[model samples]
Target: MPINILMPALSPTMEKGNLAKWLKKEGDKVKSGDVIAEIETDKATMEVEAADEGTLAKIIVPEGTQDVPVNDVIAVLAADGEDVKAAGAGAGKAEAPKPPASSFETPAARAPQDEGSAGGKTEAPTKPTTNPAPRPEEGAPAPVSKGEATHNGARVFASPLARRMAKDAGIDIARVTGTGPHGRVIARDVEQAKSGGGLRSPAAAPAAGPAIAPAMSDQQIRALYPEGSYEVVPHDGMRRTIAQRLTQSTQTIPHFYLTIDCNLDRLLAAREDINAAAPKDKDGKPAYKLSVNDFIIKAMAIALQRVPDANVSWTEGGMLKHKHSDIGVAVAMPGGLITPIIRSAETASLSSISAQMKDFAARARARKLKPEEYQGGTTAVSNLGMFGIKDFTAVINPPHATILAVGTGEQRPIVKDGKIEIATMMSVTLSCDHRAVDGALGAELIGAFKTLIENPVMMMV
Candidate 1:
């Protein structure tokens, strides 16, 4: 027996997806974990995986086809010598996938064609097969042929409702003419006829109505254009995902910003002292290089312990505080930002945090991280200090109550004991959700972080 491969819902909001590309061609062997295709959902381009070990038998929807709804069979996989018929023979021959509401570019505007006649009379007949498909109702309005007229001497191809409506409204259908289905009268035509006080003959209507200049002929446009072509490109999968997520976050989250400045001279000196005594690599780099980020991570751990409320998420029922601090560090990637978590950061040592950050950052940049690595953190940090950003606020990554953005440290004059002196100062801004965290709580949390940074020794102990 063959296994049917239905389109998977890549995102929560995704209903249908475009078959962007097939990773496994027909007859190719596939394992459960292997990526079989790249599916384009409203959010992103996700890799579709096989559910079982088998050979790719047939692809129902070819690449580039859009509107493949979720859970609809898109392909088939089977073991060698398996019968394809066992997996529904009519799989690929189902009705064409309906495009989105936006894809209905043209209005319902073509003239109806003549119905098939049997023995000199038109008759509706039932279609029979193993499928037992339903048939259209008999004795329905006859499909009008081209150049025919209705009973009132109007074009026979006019829609029945339009003709009857015209009669009820005392408007002439023939004079009104039509802009639908092979020039047949439509509802709009009847409405226009009623509004205009009967149908105006094409020649007489324009003459009596509002004056308008004729449209430029295609030949004239061709003459004006020396040479230029227009092309439309579809939105890539990654772009689609970014757009949807950002929109959702902005629309629903109630975000609030809080800023704090930290003196970093002590932090820098401490990093140097820690790195000097650490092991060295073969290439001469410190084995456990204690960077400013490492100190910040350690300081954050202590701050979280002090202000445990900050290490929590907002929920419908109540404020859900976590016993452990799981921090997600946002890493910039080619497509967008992806944060990898440092689970139980409150308990991890500075050296361990440094190692975990390095590993997760490397994997995140390489796009080799698992789904769990990028999900479920109590709080998140995004640092742009390396890029020389002075100060900035970050968006809250829900269901987390707050996110911290760190900026670069620069030498600045500060008053110490009534004397102005040059000191290294760094700025950080915390964006919080007002629903989950209050202004006073956020300020207090920042104060604790300030203490950890100003007194670096306290964090280590």
Candidate 2:
């Protein structure tokens, strides 16, 4: 059999992906776990590994192809001692699964891809999730219950029979634990779920309330503007994904914001002294230079530790309290922004965080970051200090219950002992998922952050 090389889902939030480049050309020998291609997800470019070994018999999807849906075959492989030409010929004639009309974000994606076409044939996985994950490309019907997780409010991926069974059982399919590929609920899993081990409380489902109304119709909105005055710049994959994810976030997660002003006198001085003492390289450049944002990252990480209750993700089932602080730092790029995370940030030194951030920023701008670097984090930090924005609330990217928005530091007058005095202050807004973190808990978290930030030396300990 000619083995199909399907587009793998790199993250839980990625639905479509760009087939950035084919690292291995057709007719090349392939080995298991070989990094055969690079797929560009919404936020990062990932090198995909081959799960099986064979000769690369055909390339069904070419490089730079965009918006390929998940599980669409991009290439085929010839088995050991099999005829390569026969494999290629057979695979080329095979039609990939057509994506649903709802999946098409543009006319370009809706159109079928010709060989060498820039449009992708298969996309990756993510939310903004409309359906259950496609089966693995290996063609195996996996039977294990691997605790497959669903994310970003994606619709449960269940077989038609499974859906029918659940419907007959009067069970909410969303509450059943999927045990198939990427946690897709299969027929057998559904059968086992009937015993109640797989069922979740009705509370686990989305809260019943008035739904968010749709915006004005496109035709209506266009009527208000002169036709030629506006040029239609089609949204690329990144922009579309951003719109969807943001919509999902706001609609699914109830957000509440808490703002506080921190005195930056000590932090500014500490930063200056740290940079001055930094060892210089042969190029005479400082080995490490700390930013106020660096201190903020450290403070936020420590704050999460101090007020652990605030660091949690809300699922209808329960709260997920993470042990380590994975802090995602938002970096703006061409089409959209990517939040690259610093894992275990609470334990890392200030200089380490600065260096990691610099590397993440460089890679992020190029869209060269791996999916793991940007996918899931417990919390996030968005600093517009360099942009000179005073303060703003950031959208809470789920999986992350809190996001701290940092503003520029400026000189402001404050009263001390009933007298006015000049002080350097920076304002920060913490956006919390109210379902997970209550007002008091959020206050405590931000309060701890203020203490560490105002007294910079506390972060050293």
Candidate 3:
């Protein structure tokens, strides 16, 4: 039997992905856990490893193809002496292509629904939602969730569902008009349709019938808007998953942001001293060199110790605070970003944290990070300091109550004993979810972070 290499969900939020690069070409031997390709998801470019030891036989979706949904086959790995042709033959069937938006009838053609009068009960217009069939090509105008109407000779679109109810109630879509994005008709349009007692133009009367149109390819319609060359890329598996999860998170989860500045003079000096004195590794490389990020990770671990409430997740039942400090460190990649966790950070020494960070960062860039390294964390740290960012807020990674955004440390003036002096200052912004962490608790956590970062020795203690 041939093993199909399907696109793996690189992140919890990833759905569709683009094949960034193929590490192993066809006819190459692969071992279990060997990296096969680099998949660029909305969140990050990640390594898609072989699950079984076999010979790579066929590459299905070639690199640079987009909109490959999760679990879709990208390659075939056949066993020793197996027939690659037979293995690939069974897997070569393509799924049905997504329908184009233009295939559906126009919203104005849909039958109207009944609405009650204003004296007691009133009719309402139906809202339109696209029951989009399968995958629509890129730029396939998504079916309007609302209906459409003609107002003063101008055709305005509203949700199909909304239009039905509005017409049944004897409401004039033209008089009521629209309030949706791009001046489209929405539910609000139906509500105001009755109140809009404005005079109707003679042309406001109903049309003879729906205007029928000829079928055309999506490429043809898109060509009309072309000033420059534009192409529709299908959503890869990873991108689709990302879209779904982010939509859910944004809709259901309430997010809040908090920011603070930490003095990094002591922290910077500590890292330099540690790095200078660190021992060499078996590979003759430095075993441990504490970077500013290592210190920040250590400080964050200590702060989580003081304010355990911040290291928690929200659930339907109640808050679930984590006992351990598994700090995820955000790493930037080609398409997006990934946060690989430094497990048991509270117990790990600065040297160990530094080593692990170096390893993770290198592997992350190379698209070799394992799934375990990128998932499940109590908190997260995103450092833009290396990029010279002054300060900025971060979106809360789901399930983690807080994420610390660290900025660069720059030399600035400070008052010392009534005298002007220079000090190194850095800013950090903590994004917290109110449902999981209260304002006071979040503030206390930042305060603890400030103390540990400024002292630089507290982590050692």
TM-score: which candidate is best? 2
Off by over 4 Å in 2: 13-15, 32-34, 52-54, 92-174, 177-218
Best by lDDT: 2
Higher-TM-score candidate among 1 and 2? 2
lDDT of 3 at 435: 84
lDDT of 3 by residue, 1-461 (tens): 88877877554323345678898887788998898888764444577678898788888887876546556778888887898767767667544323322333343333221111000011233744478457657745434324444554455454543466577878765655433323344453465455543224556542222222433455665667674575555433333334433443454457777787777888888888877887887898877666788889988998998888788977533576789999999887654567889998999988889889888888787767766787779989999999899999877766678889999999989888999989899989988888888889899999999999999888888
TM-score between candidate 3 and the true structure: 0.60
TM-scores for every candidate against the unseen true structure: 0.63, 0.77, 0.60
- After superposition on all C-alphas, the RMSD of every candidate to the true structure, in Å, is 17.8, 9.4, 14.8
Q: Which stretches of candidate 3 lie over 4 Å from their true place?
A: 1-92, 96-251, 280-285
**Candidate 2, number of clashes:** 11
What is candidate 2's CA lDDT for residue 392?
96
Task: Tell me which of candidates 2 and 3 scores higher on lDDT.
Answer: 2
Q: Give the TM-score of candidate 2.
A: 0.77
Q: lDDT for model 1, on a 0 to 1 scale?
A: 0.67
Q: Answer with 1 or 3, whichever has the higher lDDT.
A: 3
